[model samples]
Target: MMDVEVIENSNKCARCNYCRVCPIYTVEGWESASPRGKLYTIKSLVNGEIDVDARVVKELFKCTTCGSCEVICQVEIPLINLWENFRAHLNSKGYILPVHKKLREKTFREWNPYGESREKRADWFKDLKNLTSTNSDLLYFAGCTASYRTLSIARDTVELFNKTGLDFNYAGVDEYCCGSPFLRTGQRDLAQKLFLKNYKKWKEMGIRRIVTSCAGCYRTIAKDYPKIAEKLDYDFDFEVLHTVQILDEIVDEIDFEDVDVKATYHDPCHLGRHMGVYEEPRRVIEKMGIELIEMEKNRENAFCCGAGGGVKSQFKELALAIGELRVKEALNTNADYLISCCPFCKLHISQSLNNFDKNINVLDIVEVVIRTLNK
Candidate 1:
């Protein structure tokens, strides 16, 4: 978000209706929730046609910020950037969402968005002997979700790295937040502070390459961190690779046995569209010799898992609604395992599966590999 007005970007919306790919708009079917409608709202604000109000702010925050609209925009508007700017503007104008405000407070106090204690951040990997160390070729950054919620993914990923004989350091409790949550919520200033903290911590460890299991961390650290770094007067240029990318590189050494499960891969919005990493995760799945079922929406045109852009926390009903739609799509493929790369996506989609009373299992792509590794 720059010091300029949202009009600069909002004016670029051509109203071509190409942004119908937005999952929120697809389910809600409200023009105010569509990407095109949001841009018009911003323009209205700029032209003094409307004042900042809770209703307007609520409509703005309904967006998932999955970057789908920006991908298909006919006029090439920076819709993601514009939406973030609009949020920031609203925040400055005291039209902040109450849930987002509390989330910001929790992130600042707990150093994690879930309001969980930072002391237990690395408790996920405490059982692995000699797995946590420094002065290695790379640092395995177990993001907050992986470290706290998806413990198995973190453990399996570290085990996979060791099996492949990669020299990587694990930044356990010391690993600061990658600021993905805050950035998605337009708390860029707080995000920059975390960015500086993480960068300085990594610099002290002399870390060269960084690998993360979570897709949001991948997008935040790899894509947004650089821009945040420049804004905060910090200089850093280290390589950040998602675990899928690293696994794709070492696929030759890892032996995955055939599994009897029919799995459909869910493209996490940040990893696939935000980072352009559609092939690597799929390559890992294909190499395992399992049948890959195609979802009606996959890759760039893929539907969002409804977890991005703080929607999962604030708009619970809308989030679950979109996730259920995705789960129904996966169930349509008759896939036993609904595999996705990001832990957040797994969490949301898995919850939605419970609502449908379906027997589908939502597993991370890496988790799927870990199950079949050496079997």
Candidate 2:
């Protein structure tokens, strides 16, 4: 039998071209790249009008899962979930992309998609003593990207937590990947295992509030985990928060020295459209006394940085092309820095800026706060 959700969501597409404003569609310029076009493809495949092929796989997986198309869908179809369900369906039939398969393998082996050693996961802040006690109720989940690739964001977040006298526990070496990559790439079984592991660990540790610096991690934990928990018949009771949410709540309590820089914020797809966390990060930037400029596309309508949904891993050229467009928009603001809440976004956007030979600093919001505090 065909996947009912895929067929239903695809049939719901009005084809009014609203989802044509998508970032991938902008770069690829093919109807197949547009969300509308993909929906048609999905319906045709599910109805047996078309067979599963490489072109079909590419067109489907090319999406960034940014939720922009979902925002524009007139019929209010849940596009993100549909995409994941279809991808999961495809994976079960052995249509998984090679890189995405490797990603799953790495995550299973190292507990992170980056293939970094699990023992070294907490090396970034293991020496920062007295700030993170395992006995604390608040857990700081400095996700895989922040812990492994963007070490400074993790350090800065820990510093901010310490400065604010916020007692939190770091899962340290025991922290597994929150399973964002697995879910996005259609490894549902792997994602469920990760959810169970993390959820049970938190429950056993008496964790009440979970905080993360990466937007992907925040979205996965705060939004995706609960759904998986319900499916698995587990009770999820933890309060998940992004670092900006916590920082926003404590902003007035800190002494922030003015940092003289004009910066524009890029809304990470996971944080902005997926989770409706548009203003908190912006409000925090404003609290630092830095001039925050608006991009041509900002908040709900913001273009993706092209790092999500396993696009960056599988379609490198396509991902960079999309990233270049967003970086150009950041350059148009002529700000001294481009600020974003996600380390993954910073990594991709910075790469795009370099490829275009443009000079502009990319910093996470926590990095900005730490800079102001020291100055």
Clashing pairs in 2: none
Model 1 score (lDDT): 0.84
> Where in model 2 is the C-alpha error above 4 Å?
129-134
Candidate 1 per-residue lDDT over residues 50-159, each given as its tens digit: 98677888888997889899889888877787888777767666666788888788878888888888888978788888654546969998888888788888888877
- Per-residue lDDT of model 2, residues 57-110, tens digit only: 978998889999899888999999988888999999989898998988898899
TM-score of 1: 0.96
Clashing residue pairs in candidate 1 (N, C-alpha, C atoms within 3 angstroms): none
> What lDDT would each prediction earn against the true structure?
0.84, 0.89
